[model samples]
Target: MSALGAVQPAEAAGGTRAERGDRESLFRPLSAEDGEQLPAEIESLCMNCFQNGVTRLLLTRIPFFKEIIVSSFSCDSCCWSNTEIQSAGRVQEQGVRYRLAVTSRQDMDRQVVKTDCATATIPELDFEIPPFTQRGVLTTVEGIIDRAIAGLEQDQPIRRATDEGVAQKIEEFIGRLRQLKEAQSPFTLVIDDPSGNSFVENPRAPQRDDALVVTRYRRSPQQAAALGLQGEELEEPAEPAEDLHNEVLQFNTNCPECNAPAHTNMKLVQIPHFKEVIIMATNCESCGHRTNEVKSGGAIEPQGTRITLRITDPSDMTRDVLKSETCSVEIPELEFELGMGALGGKFTTLEGLLKDVRDLVERNPFTLGDSSAPDRTQKLQEFIGKLQEIIEGQRTAHFVMDDPAGNSYLQNVFAPEQDPEMQVQHYERTFQQNEDLGLNDMKTEGYEEETGSR
Candidate 1:
């Protein structure tokens, strides 16, 4: 039996089976002639007919992504059939969002892999397919719209019998959806997968697809809890018997890399003339993966802080910098901007941060393989070259760090005298910024009154 609990093909028709590993067993595409037969189906109870039927499972790898298991069920008694897909690989560390512009009818033929954790949205019509509303599927763009139509139409008959007004409104909405199939006007299709398991096809692979924009972002605490990730339940231990500010504390935790038991060592350190900060380091023996994260120990400041430094000398790279989780880094010279949460809180030198940024851009999955475009590739290369020159002290550029939480820091070589090349400014955070940090929703003043009313 394969990993999907189905019979393995004794001999794949035209497909080749790679040597099975402890973690993954890969199967290539099988010839249509013997595809379904060789794999052999397993008897499954049909939901519609309550009779014995066969379910076929095929495990194959996607060209640009990872492996997936495709399954189909059919019942000859009722002629009922269904198809679904499941990601056979591990979930990524960060969630992914794909924005695709559907301008032509041919765009509808592009393939899509939408995991159960993904939500599809058509902004133009304000129509959305929420996660878990339907089973995971390996289908085309058109197929997604068709599925939405099917779902809306499924309940129309009942609504028509009960409420004529609601049914008429739905009928008109369905008509609009049908017109979208014509692809007369361009519309944006967004697929947001917090699990990072979903994928949308790019007809132009190995090259940049101007119509598609992909973004990877760190998951929120709520999202992490929903996915059952570790560290959420671990509360800060009561101040140890020893002074924690001067001592390192170790606690058992699961490794984010391998999901194996590991110990995380944490320490609270007070920066000279600054603030207290907590640092955590974790190492996994199972996967030989090591990670460290820094967190601010104080609450959000009353105003945001922005620091700008003119980098002219190579010595500037040696200056220590502390970047909080809510900070954004920008270098106008390279036309580069890194938003918050790209790299979690980090305490490193100025040079280290730039190198990290370069690595992040270079390691982008879409920049490689068939999805990379020549012009896009050239632009990236040029940008990287300029960044390298800056790192090598061959160029001069202004580096800016903006932290809405007002916790980030950039070292001042001149200390109390203040460096002539740097400027620090403080400003109040906007309502949207406060909302993003969940500050606007907080009720610190009168929660007791609301509770008494309840």
Candidate 2:
């Protein structure tokens, strides 16, 4: 049976709601069979015939993706059928963009999960499939080309009879699209999903795919508004609230793990003689997940900050560390490096950050699948062992953090006097670094006149 057909409702397992709630809701194995049961259907008017038809719905979870409701409509009178997939999960914390190089016929056969909110762009042809233009689908890359061809051909006959010029241009475009499907030349397929639910198949799974690059980015305010995630922004006040900096302020938020309602506590903290910062902590009672984040309370510094610490003593792990979301971490001894935004913002000790890094690598889905190689697994094991040894003070390593925004901090044991083992340097940020931080696009100096003219 197909992946969609083999799935049954969560109730099939015969568990109480409370019992199932203990685990991730609606999370169950999708590898088994339950095809004997008929799918739930509802009577609906079919668009093809305007006649009464049946719409079948199935709730199934994709292997990599969360729960999704797959629906299919059939019209007996018109012999028409339509299938659609809708995400059943909550919005993710970050948007995902996938860039894939399609160079061969095998690449064309790769499966893709295109969510309704994803935009597929082909830079080579200057063609784009905008969001909401097509229903979400579980199909191969070739199938997408075929669908585009069918859409273009659907109205060609009418256009040809009246507007031959337009029809001719469309025909040429269709020919080019057909050539793309044949994989005659190398091209790029970009899927940008604001909902972070879309996916393109990776032929090399457990290992990194050289031809595919995946990036997660924070959505713009406009994009967040489009996704119905924009919250009310508090306006700055001329006067500060009484004791606001000293008190922990609480606010309601959804849990990232389970999307359950939770509370986040925020507090303003001053790092003695250094700078003020805002610390936020969230705890989800339902999932027992906790997270702490720190944001720089002051204005952006003129230069970037880089801190390097030599970890020689076990007490070094106990020192407080603030790793901003824009910080990149590295350990030269192990040849290990972590890029910016890998762990988001953190307000924790050195040991805690190292533990989080170890957990992130160990729990990565790519390292556990059938595509995982024995050699790769062994290497990861060795790397993880080294990290554990460092955490346990069995070995020495150099820890480096580079923050282009100059917001990260590492507590110094000898505060009044600089520590011999730690080195802090402030340097001008490069052009590319400013661009990555969105500083290049900011026009703070001339914004008054520009806004008035607009």
Candidate 3:
């Protein structure tokens, strides 16, 4: 039998009403333009338990989301009923995430959220909420917290491992959480999803509020694994993923510099501690020029990371580095700064990257030998000498990487931070950067840069 009744246009919803004593209500649709002109009927069996039911998928339109299809299904043979959504258009240019601060009760009902591939967390309490492949949520701030409560209540690992005392403390914590919900106390809710499928409500009307923080980032390898993007093939013997990695994919595209067709090389590499990443290299045989790029195979980091290495000896030159395309590399001694797209991202040692930088400067038409600007040429020559010395362990230098997307890394198998020579700091992206990244509705007027100590 059909789980949904009939396809009809959505009208004004009698919005969820709540008394102080009642539980928070579900989100109410506020005057949709038109919804479900036609509903698609399909066969339905619960992917979970193999229960049978007929499904009805209705098409609708959201404000910023454009086309959306909401699917409703209920299994008659089992207790499985769900309403999920599939957006036809995308809102984020990259992996999207959100941080909503719940300070008032009204903020809860003014938003919509999705957690399909998200790892929601409230760091203050060390609570992590995993999306169980359920539909994205269209609810308020209170609803977000309630979902976290539900996950904690049903957490099997904690329940199985904890004794009565620990279990009691957990229950007490949950009670405090409920109290906070009712009290509308302030708490930060972070949703990190690399799929770019999640959404936090924003009405582009009169000025929007700043209680919620929205971000788009490049995912790391480890974060991508949480979304089941990698490591799944390792379980069952799979030749496809392995074979594809070994076989280099090539393309025939015209070079940006030369009119001649360029041969492009692309292959996947699994970084030891990080996730699998694809390296793309393009070479123009006509002009004898080459270009390369590295992309993180995981979910983008929520915050940006800055890595600094003091090269005291040549051995430091061998330290592995993963520089993302969005990363910026700088050498203070040379007064040289290369922004994103300098060489694109690559997995190389510190020495190798520096070599590429010097080579790039050397080849630049403006920076070539004995320039019209003699003083500038002298500085470049001295910088090159110092770089060579550092490579040969004759002089020391400092290497700094500032990445707003936080995908770049300087590999330190040991605790580099403890050595006092290496430093890793994660800072909140500046107001200008957030604007540049298309993170609208941000207000960082008096915002001080907060540094995260590694």
lDDT value, candidate 1, whole model: 0.79
Cα TM-score of candidate 2: 0.74
lDDT of 3 by residue, 1-454 (tens): 2333222112111112222112111111223323324566787778778977768775544433334457777777777777766543333324766777767666566556565666677776777777654566556667776866776688645664867677777788888779757845677778777777676664321112367666667666675676656642323422445487678877676654434577878787877655677788887766566777788866556688888888886678888889987788887866667765447688889989989887765543223422224565566577678778878888877889998877887877565235567888999988876665556574445455443331
The residue pairs that clash in candidate 3, if any, are: 108-140, 108-141, 218-300, 219-299, 219-300, 220-299, 221-275, 224-299
Q: lDDT tens digits, residues 1-454, model 2?
A: 1333444333333233364474333433232244432456888888877999888876655543455666888999999999877665556778999899999999999878888889999999999999989999878889888988999999999999999999999999999999999999889999999889887866543234678877788788878888887892444633456897778888888777555688999888888756888889999887576888888888778899999999999999999999888898988887787777767888889999999989877764335544345676677778889999999999999999999999899999998898999999999999988987889988889889998999
Q: Candidate 2, clashing residue pairs? A: none
Badly placed stretches (over 4 Å) of model 3 are 1-38, 47-51, 77-79, 89-93, 131-135, 154-162, 203-208, 223-454
lDDT of each: 0.79, 0.79, 0.64
Which has the higher lDDT value, candidate number 2 or candidate number 3?
2
RMSD of 3: 20.5
The order by descending TM-score is 2, 1, 3
How many backbone clashes can be found in candidate 2?
Answer: 0
TM-score of each: 0.71, 0.74, 0.42
Error of 2 at 155 (Å): 4.0
Candidate 2, 251: how far from true, in Å? 3.1
TM-score of model 1 (CA atoms): 0.71
Ranking by lDDT: 2, 1, 3
Give the clash count for each candidate.
11, 0, 8
Question: What's model 3's TM-score?
Answer: 0.42
